[model samples]
Target: MLVNPHICPAETTVILHICPVEMLVNPPTALAEMSVSPLICPVKTSVSRLIALAEMSVTRHIWPVETLATRWSTVTPVQQRRSSTLAPVQQRRRSTLAPVQQRRRSTLAPVQQRHRSTFSPVQQRRRSALAPVHQRPCSTLAPVQQRC
Candidate 1:
């Protein structure tokens, strides 16, 4: 992740898919029901909380946070929105194509890269005549200023 305060990834700030340990300790109100965890993460930048949960065994009910929601879901993913001076929606950007080391792809992150129009395959080069060079930043631009 870019770790930029002004550019928090919206995906992480939203509800994380995790079930409560209560599911393991007691029978469900409905058989095979999975309970959703309360809001552990709020909508804000620079606020990251690492959470821990018990492993699921004896049943295939529990798995990684990401998988649990997809496999079994009784509650909709909570989506909360609040105004933040930082991390504006238009300013927020995400990219999964980076790891933390040499010849490193960190710069390839969307944090500094500008919006690119359709062009030839990325297999060629990131910069081309149609896409041109990305010299401007990612802030909202006026129509006249948006050329490139």
Candidate 2:
């Protein structure tokens, strides 16, 4: 089975089939119902605090320090207006293609390469009018720019 590089694939597939033991226990309320370990309580609490600190540190590194929310302020109206304008342009570009069109465009070149010899199948397909060479996806354009 193929695994996604960005996530822990083992944890993901296990989640699909069964609830994890930790999830079966409701952490906050269930502590009242069961006899808890004294040593474990401090360890668990510190682990959670460490996780939160680590997450915050990563975010601080990734975004500007001055941008972190302070108690006094809300987002400025000018920033909101600028973001709203850009969002629609991005969404329109994303939403224009139906899944079939998206899939056809994604898979076309890979299919061409698997079928033929050293002669470029893309040029051949263009000549045959199977796909307008002009309609080639943006990924194809990336390599030409990279080479230059």
Candidate 3:
């Protein structure tokens, strides 16, 4: 799967499916075929063009990062504003969550360590007891007979 961090997440899945082989062979023919295919819903002409461009870049073996970045930059101002607004909210969420996460980890670490320390010896003893059974001895007797 092609994952370009520059591209918005919503578009990434769709864009990833635009294969180089399809574009290199013939974008128009490929798009036309895809349009008529029962599986593919009719996409807007602009979206189809973008998919074609993305696929074309794959054929040229160009990294899609720059292309996606440029394309994203050309997105309407409304989308730009929406993204900009989301940035601070995301930052605020991170800033708020960081200390809580750190506190949780700090509290959990000691409990986990204690639990591990208490259980480890018992677990080791159980494993050691089982190990001999797992490593069957070269004996004529069956396991039950050997144990008995």
The lDDT values for all models are 0.41, 0.68, 0.76
Instruction: Please write out the lDDT profile of model 1 over residues 57-137, one tens digit for every residue.
Output: 323453454465444544354412222332365354322222334226566655335434333356356555436335556
Per-residue error for 14 in candidate 1, Å, reads 83
Best by TM-score: 3
Error of 3 at 35 (Å): 30
Predicted structure 2: lDDT: 0.68
TM-score of decoy 3: 0.36
Backbone clashes, candidate 2: 0
Which ranges in model 1 have alpha carbons more than 4 Å from their true place? 1-57, 64-75, 79-148
Error of 1 at 25 (Å): 52
lDDT of 3 by residue, 104-143 (tens): 9999999999999999999999999998886876595587
Cα error of candidate 1 at position 89, Å: 14
| TM-score, model 2 to reference | 0.24
> Which scores higher on TM-score, 2 or 3?
3
Of the two candidates 2 and 3, the one with more favorable lDDT, higher being better, is 3
